[model samples]
Target chain A: MRCFRFWPALAVISLAACTTAFPQAPNYGNLGRTPSKEEIQAWNQAIGPQGKELPPGSGTAKQGQEIFANKCAACHGPAGEGSQLAPRLVGGRGALNIPTPSRTLANYWPFATTIWDYINRAMPPKQEGSLSASDIYALTAFILYRNDIIPEGQVIDATSLPKVKMPNRDGFIPQRLEDIHDLRARGCGAGHCP
Target chain B: MSSKRSLRRQFLKNGAALAGFAAGAISSPAGKLFAADAPSADLHAYGQRSHFENDVRIGSLAMWPIVPGARRDYGFRSPLQDSMGIITPAPLHFIISHGHEPPDIDPREHRLMIHGMVDRPLIFTLDEIKRLPAVSRLHFLECHGNSAAAGPTGEPRKALAATVQDTHGLTSCSVWTGVPLALLLGQVGVQKGANWIVAEGSETGKHSKSIPLEKALDDCLVVYGQNGEALRPEQGYPLRLLVPGWQGINNVKWLRRIYVVDQPYMAMMESTKYPSARLDGKSRWFESEMGPKSVITRPSGGQQLGARGFYEITGLAWSGGGAVRRVEVSADGGRTWKDAQLQQPIAPKAHTRFGLAWTWNGEEAVLESRCTDDQGHVQPTLAGLNKFWGIDADYYRLPPATADMGNFNAIQPWRVSRDGSVSNALL
Candidate 1:
């Protein structure tokens, strides 16, 4: 049961030796093969705010409406108008300032690329990662058009997706480490704060 | 000749009676049953209580369907009122998932890819990772959205219909065994300016979250073992990320890939789901670490006491910041407090058990517990927590629905009736 034990003296000696000696990379003999480029590409699918990793695909709002009805309408509701199952995607515009803020994609999402990234990676609940790149773009475009953020005929692709400005783009503030420290000082009893 | 015949007859009669008794015993119902069929005094190789033992986890009836017609995605709270000690049994641990059951993974086929923002991107198989230096530590993992039922009034009375599990059941402590993430990062050689690492799961939903590099390097573990055995399927069978002291979501289960990056990916979960509004009219994202909190597990809500004279009040207390230093129990609803005895070996970022002996006079009394961590952070009252969040007197009518989801560690009170029935205190 006692599988681990401490060796303080040996650990200290090793640490001193490491600092005194000229540092060199310790090779751990290769145990696994390097992954192929295709394998790497398949797993590295996260698209950030800049949309730099968006794959080559294009779709229009009209095409997205059909795909949405077939794939997403069951959970997200028809026309993305909200349902008891999933969140509302279209409305909630200018609702963040109200007492009961309805934080929908149209109102609260800071980056449109997030929409594409999330859909591409996880969506349609029952069948995730089943949609093609073009289908994801179309769904993104349809949601944008329904929210009144984009025109009806606009085509959404890698280039246009990142440019779509969301209403609550400025809603979030960077987390401050100092604020946590201050809270700890006030919340933690006097003289015991971290 | 007469004497010999009498003796032979007597012997024959005795033998006949013995044979009939033996036949009847073998034909009886109890003799026909096997060892497994009924309770026995003998021991088993792997211990399992008889079916007659009624100590079981009571599922909460308040669980609602997640996707309308789908009951598979439903959540079950832990029965806190029925829990006994610091560590929760794996079966009784609270479960919350995003609309899918935990995926079963084969260890042989599993691989953990450490790529992006690293000098030497590498993929590690389950066997290869296990061969590396290992560490075992006890830590408590709690969901960021835990204890939503306990509102600002300090009274979770509505949750009485449900067990304590419904109110504050989404937390558990266990001994985790894994290779330190820092060692893996060192092997991969993290590149400069990499501030974030996105940990992704292989679940059907591809549940993912962005973790700060500082945390990833500090005490994070790519864990594969829990409570001294291979993890349960529900707890991510083959592998999981153990972000000690952080919220449960950050500890991604079924861990498959880790992408080192210069900035947080701001995934849907992190951006839209985890962040909560603050009193300053701003939102705080990645409120990862849990605050100091404690709950009176015994005599908590639904349990009834029979002729209470001398009773022991005990519960579990934990803090994400550090080891719990002291726990205070109040028998008269915070009007008076007494220091409770903290159990030995209080591990950092682990649940510590505390107990106090009290003499009940069979009168109505309110019991509560407050814990303070080594870092000096004390558990806050419900009203104090509401005030910290800038909620006003009309909080019940217009609750801060969005802001108060995370970091909800309010003092829980239990009302003991003179008639020996214990219930949630409506403070």
Candidate 2:
């Protein structure tokens, strides 16, 4: 059996010698070929409807400060004042029902993931979606700080960002399942969602 | 241009002489009077107002005003401050759209086609539509996103940049004369499998909505005439769908087609963009009915209070669900509530005006009004709403489920100061 294997190896070596383009395909135009499974898997990372596609590489809040100042501060303002150009990102933690002159994400924005997904898909304006995985991690950390979730020197990354609790995260209730029966039972009228 | 200029000069010159003659004739008395010579409907032509109004007016000629900007995605706001009474005048109502220019539809060439799951898929001409059994009602049609503003919080609440009219002004009520959708469905004979009817507009990409067939047969209408005249161009001239108590989008404008199906069409209006409240962590969709809401038109923001004398706090309250039974006013914040007087004969799905007498103490206090519809649904407080529906959700249609269900009916308090500045107390 060993002798037969050696013979096959020898045959393959000879076959390679017969081709003119030894490490390259001679038919380059046919290069519209499917990539190998491994190659496809490497770039298929995406966070999705089920929260399964998160990529690797975590960062911290301290690192996030650097990322925010460098990439986000210009448009959102140094203190997140928000401009006609872009919306303010933080501050105003409890202005929901007070006679204050200001409000920000700290008082409103319902979901933490909304922040993450928004930044991931649309932030770093000049080069949206161009932030590296680590850059996103760091930026998330910085914003959480500005929102006053985590203090200075706190490091945010995949692990900590998801765990960091948010106010008003549970503000909305799921839509009630209603049909003709429900509508009639409820005496469907204006203001009532039937 | 030259002819117009000459006509104006001639009219001015003759008008002066005519005025002199009329003045002399009236002085002489009897049959000499020019009262009978006043302009009549024959001389004035159609579309002219019988009486002049001091209030700001727009789009009077076409029945609908053309918004200043041509971009279909944008529209003009209604002049809420300038308007009087509960019913927003047809011309001053805010007009919003989604990428559809005004269509030049000919009623003679138009046909409202009812198809899909039906015993008889029939196409009715504009005349045939008018001839069908008709029912008229005075109701209000409002946009779900009408009050898009920057909330007292940092997040945008009523986002509209225009006046309260722009934000809350896209509402109107008129005697709509047309065939009841129920009668039409009876005529067409909707099949048992038909549960949803998708209303289509003439504008491309803007046509489509899935409405429950039962609801359609109940209160929907194929409206033609508005305010005793044919529908205006901006108001879906020729024809439009009126789903009573439903969101404005459900009432498709420039309606061109109707498709009945067992399942919802899953159109863009239903799948995405409409606001839904989140409850217990799930998103709601296709919420058509607007909640009971009220706006204190008088003493509203930007209005000047000349003095601290007793003044009437007057405003309009309406519910897409039903008639507004009562509206409560809180002059000292939400601490105490007193019922405001509701105007007589409150009709269902109509704008009912409410008034209350208040004596300003010339102190910084909160003034708020909360409406309770016939359905017994009370208005939620801003703080209570913020607990579940973050002020920054960007979507007002459906709020999310949160630990803050306890805050559902928090009183929406408005702060008023001696300086006459009125703002949300929940700043």
Best-performing candidate as measured by TM-score: 1
Candidate 1 regions exceeding 4 Å error are A1-27, A175-194, B1-46, B54-74, B150-157, B160-162, B278-282, B397-404
Clashes of each: 0, 57
Candidate that scores best on lDDT: 1
lDDT of 1 by residue, A1-194 (tens): 01112445466556656543424434556854567778878998888776877889999899999999998888688878767667788776755544445567887777788899888877877578899999999999999999999999999999999899877666665543223323243343311122
The docking category that best describes candidate 2 is: incorrect
Candidate 2: tens digits of C-alpha lDDT, residues B1-427 = 1233324333432342233222111110001112222345664466444343323221112111222321123334454544456666666555555534567899998767776567666667787777655777877777665553332111222322122333355566666778788776665567776667878777534446768887898888999987777888878889999987777788888887777666554443443345343433333345567778777665554344545667787777777778889999988777898899998658888878888998877787677888999889777666545554555333333332211111122344445667654544444
Runs in model 2 with CA error above 4 Å? A1-194, B1-43, B47-75, B148-163, B275-282, B388-414, B424-426
DockQ of each: 0.25, 0.06
Model 1 lDDT per residue over B250-272, tens place: 88889999999877777888878
lDDT of 1: 0.71
lDDT of each: 0.71, 0.57
Question: What is model 2's interface RMSD?
Answer: 16.6
